[model samples]
Target chain A: MTTQPHEHIVKSYDEEQRRLVEEIVRMGQTAVAQLEAALDVVDRRDDSAARRIVANDDSIDAAERRISQDVMRLALRGPMARDLREILAGLRIPSDIERIGDYASNVAKRSIALNASPPMPHVAGLRALGLLAAGQVRQALRAYSEDDDELALRVRENDAQLDRQYTALFRELLTYMMEDPRSITPCTHLLFMAKNLERIGDHATNIAENVWFLLHGDRPLPPRDKRDDTSTAGPA
Target chain B: MTTQPHEHIVKSYDEEQRRLVEEIVRMGQTAVAQLEAALDVVDRRDDSAARRIVANDDSIDAAERRISQDVMRLALRGPMARDLREILAGLRIPSDIERIGDYASNVAKRSIALNASPPMPHVAGLRALGLLAAGQVRQALRAYSEDDDELALRVRENDAQLDRQYTALFRELLTYMMEDPRSITPCTHLLFMAKNLERIGDHATNIAENVWFLLHGDRPLPPRDKRDDTSTAGPA
Candidate 1:
């Protein structure tokens, strides 16, 4: 059977759309791996490995730029409303993933500074928080690729766990700093690292919301809990 | 002379583009004002005012959604490559501005926590950093509206100044915490606030780069220095 011109166009456009989504998912996986690698560096105090992860963030950034170019090219083809939403999601989800890469890089950078002092037990808490954040990002990416709004909502709901973990880490680090003046410098580094992990969770939530926007258009997302209360937190 | 239908369509498209730029500028101005107000509350130690600023962040978020909708509508109109670049900028610039608003709100939130302790001299340093960040955001927005690549580059260059200010503040707070353990809690809050302000500067830089991308599509930008060395920072 001979393929018609209109069929060819439709097939090519669908292929482009599939390619764009696949690229975004790959980029997101890179960011997740970067975060896990960073967490490992924190536990092992591997400054060189941390530096490598920091440099690797550029790949995710390059991915974002490429995805943007693809979206713009596809967009200029006069996409319909549904395709336009896909184009917008293509733009936004990568931006969020790029930021996740940055947060992961920041965590790795802080780990190098964290290595200056003796190891503290708080690194385990940070690891737990980082793992949770990575899971959120992974699930969000799955939701994006699968068009699973249910999974996106789950990712949003799960961010509260990451926030609570961060708050606990925040209070723990503060108490540790107060107990030993010498631990103040390293503990401060830990605090910023923890904040970065929490923000990674936020970025994951953003990606999930973008997935919802992709599927549901202008419908408002159900309000999720924001448990990151460290900004208002006081001494324990 | 009677205007043709095509000419009328061209004029309307031009108007839509102009309106998009103007809306983004206005939204950016709101974020800058929010940051300035957050800095004010930090200086005044006004928890109520801080809460107000936090609540006002919703306006910036709403503006972002509106701008995104406008961009999508324009993009689906089958714009040329140049106009498509503008549409992309419309998406990206507002996202950066929204993040700036979030950072500003975070500063305000932390100020409330900071109020639990005696006011320290570091608030002045924070205010200075915030003003610098706000100026960067304002300048980046102006660059976007005016199509001023030179001004965008200038804004990007000036972020180094913000970073140096942040690093100095980081050292000061760390030293203060090490000397007096009683100050650790408040100092930790100040450190995060400083980080938030520093991040606002980073977001401004992102906007500036987006302006550059809008003006010069696919052209590589010159490398700029990054002076935020706190990630590698140790005891001062």
Candidate 2:
């Protein structure tokens, strides 16, 4: 029952891969929590708390740096084709997560300025969008940890819904700005905040796509619908 | 004297690496060109040309995919520590370039909507910000191709100037919107376009940092200033 040296190497490599997945999952969760916390500060108009969330983004950035070092170390072990895919995903996914953290931090930062103005009803819409984006990110992280292509595909399919929500809110904000001249400054802040949430959804979708690549290699992903039409939107 | 087989493999590997750098440089140039074209359409208010620029973004995306495949292939060749850095840069720099293309497309898309409105003087300001961003991106690409860390640092340091320009334009747009409520819709579009240009500047800094990583391994980058203050800006 003695283990060969090759078997020992394989086991150690397996453990390293598992550690990489675990670290990414933790990093993803940190980003998700940051997003939720940012939404909370927006709801309560808690400027100090929002600033804290902005400061907290550095931890997610540090996590990315550490994971990158780990990926580089693992990559130098001369992995095979499949492990090479893992290495690529290892690099790609963390960068996406770091961006998610940034968007969340941006949301918090905007919430601080948003508090300076009188409260608007659009904050509720932004919170809902932020929650949907957080949920998608959570699902994508799970898919990556469990290696679930089905869940990854689900996350990818769900981005269009987020996009649609974003577009609806975008039109609503524009209408609001048009009606009330006094609301222009605050409404502009809400608009940027909502856009940040939409971008968070896009980043979640990016993580999901990386998960698919990790599982399926070079197989093409089916074309999915993109419903984020705000760029072409105008004042109606 | 006859060359050894080992030397032949080394020569071919060097050639492959050179090809990778060339492809990335070309891809980066495509993105820069897209940014400039998007600005042109903004200046001329040409909806058809803007749409064409939007369509051309697909090419930059395809370039990124091709570069990623090449990086994976190089990674599989079991490169040494230095080459591993190259492979990592090969993956990262193009993803940034691809995003630059996307932001350029967004600018073009927004320009279509903007064309429907009366032209304003702010397009000139956006053009200025975009050209600065494009210049930074061009320098970053050159730094990558030449492996010049000093030039990369210069690109990194120059982002604060871009940010200041963006914030100034942001405040100006906000002031314009407040003064003439009739201008809010078009001004809003300009705001987003300016934000896209600002994000382009940030991506250029990312590329410059990646170049630094490629050259210096794990050494920490010197802290740089960030001047994008629009998130906290208020209407004056």
Candidate 3:
């Protein structure tokens, strides 16, 4: 919650809003860790890491549920003006975090799917690219925790680079599939995981936009700016 | 707007909640149209239809903005009890609808990608599967507008069939690519479109769950039931 000087007028109100921020940060930190573990599963083919991400998802879901209940509870007290925006921002950010968790879980599932396949060269590249995307998620979480719009805007701008990374890796994956038909199965799984990471970056951007709104009330939603992931991605 | 017969405690409050429902119905109707246009693009390789969906997304975004604005305004009025859930549902449903539109647009974009590929035989199968998913979207929207929990629950149950349809298509598309490597690029686009439709169904379920809460008070978010799309999808 952005604190206006007048806001601490109600001490419990300030405390409740602080609780909301605390929940978002806790939820976000867990989600970011989940994304890293999910990628490490792909990079190392570590079944245990993948299972941990999959198992941990339920707790993330629970975290979002707690935040949602808290938001609705506080809204019962009738927050006005900026306080209302803070509650609405609460509604928006958790779903994005929950989805980021889902994407990470999906990646872990892909690890299970690819478990039988022989390792390929591009797994390292996918993780390299994935780390770039993960860093953005971390930054977005920071922006929210600190109410730092400049950091949020930087995350928003750098998202195009993530899209480009996905596009480039997509081409490499396709070439790998084409050159050796046997690579098709595991490669396709990798493709979906790569797309999932790119989307994770987009979800991070979604959170950054909310942070922007939390700081400044109503700005028409920023027109999406970026070469979407398909820019260098094949025919599509 | 689930009516408690004894309570029109504040007439303006009841009307405001009704207006909120009306806005969601309007948003749902436009989204349903966008889904149809998006599917038509896949069926006909219709560029103009795809363009129409891409262009009309602005209106859908506007619709969400209006609802969010209205919800914030009503929250300021201090809705509690049943009215609180209605406002929370308003927060929940529109974001899901906005995402459904984004997926529809992605499908439309995929239509353009496949327009040039020597038409694959599986295109029709994709369209058929897409319609099954679309019908659920329609049903979910109707459930919200009518406050029909049974219809919503039926939508929830039928989602399994959509997942099965997508998994089946994934296997088929993979087989097509393997049989003719030349088919890989186009088939991959179609694969993504199929996945998009599958995700659209997931979004519909997300909305259906919100409908469930709107009608009944607080319920633990249902653990996701049914076959996820990956149930039979091939190796990662």
Best by DockQ: 1
* Model 2: per-residue Cα lDDT over A1-236, one tens digit each: 68588878878888998998999999999999999999999999999999899999999998987897778777777446667778888988999999999999999998888888888898888999999999999999999999999999999999999998888888898888778877888888888988988998898899999999889987999998865677787755
Runs with alpha carbons beyond 4 Å of true place in candidate 1: A1-3, B1-3
- Measured against the native two-chain assembly using Cα atoms, what DockQ does each of the candidate structures obtain, in the order listed? 0.75, 0.65, 0.43
Best by TM-score: 1
- Residue A156 CA error for candidate 3 (Å)? 0.4
* lDDT per model vs. reference: 0.90, 0.90, 0.81
Angstrom error of the Cα, residue B28, model 2: value is 0.1
Off by over 4 Å in 2: A1-3, B1-3
DockQ of 2: 0.65
Worst 10 residues of 2 chain A by lDDT: A73-82
Total backbone collisions for each predicted model: 0, 0, 0
For all predicted structures, in order, the TM-scores are 0.97, 0.96, 0.92
The pairs that clash in candidate 2 are none
Model 3, range A123-158, lDDT digits (tens) per residue? 887897778877998899899989999999999999
True contacts kept of 3: 0.28
CAPRI quality of model 2: medium
